[model samples]
Target: MTVAGEWIEKITGPFEDKKRYREYKARTKLLPESHRTAVEALDRYLMYFGSIGKSDVLLRMVDDLIDLFERAAADGTPVRDVVGEDPVEFAEEFLANYADGMWINKERDRLRRAVERAAGEESEKEGESPR
Candidate 1:
């Protein structure tokens, strides 16, 4: 599903409004990849907390995050510094300010494992140990 559809499903439950979802999906596709990913992550974070209904706050937070990233990129901050070599740690740290539950703990472990697996695959492609 498109990020928009995924968000809509999260907010209103499955298959709530196909037309509006499609519209949002199309609009989302127009966003830059970085912006899209940030928005998606924010959506997932809010959904995990069952706060998707708070669209206004979520939107503002996502916008602020995107702005921060954009400014950092403009200032020549390395992507690794922004997202970290371990995306799970970075994600957990970033979400810590917004999240307050056991869900984040489990999600952090899952994210870490997924990032480590991806890094391992990349290392293999480069003929190096994951280390």
Candidate 2:
């Protein structure tokens, strides 16, 4: 598999597994109130794609959406401010940018490298060989 394919598979594995999905759903209850809505949104979005088995593109989109929310939250930005009045429109605009050839390939490469680097760091921490 290509690096992007490997990264997507790794990230989406839990969402694809029934047992993991149940565990993830249960764990959401423990998140802070501020983060709960974002988690729920991600869950619903994942489910929408899961039902259709359209995971390849879904994984990329979900990854981007999660990063966007995480950065916004970490920066203490209100969801309303980040997404504006119509979140659907905001998301559509965000996705449209990726539909452009230049942005899509650049973003994909960046995500792939980030995932690979994170995996390597994790393996190093555990004293295991990197993949």
Give each model's clash number: 0, 0
TM-score of model 1 vs. true structure: 0.39
User: What ranges in model 2 sit over 4 Å off?
Assistant: 1-32, 42-53, 95-131
Best by TM-score: 2
Model 2, backbone clash pairs (residues 3+ apart or across chains), number: 0
- Taken over the whole model, the C-alpha lDDT of each candidate is 0.58, 0.59
Per-residue lDDT tens digits for candidate 1, residues 1-131, read 99998897887755534454554556545556765565466447645643433344344445555666666556766656667677566655665555543444567788987886777965766788886
| Cα lDDT over the full model 1 | 0.58
TM-scores of the candidates in the order shown: 0.39, 0.41
TM-score of 2: 0.41
Best by lDDT: 2
Q: State the lDDT at 36 in candidate 2.
A: 59
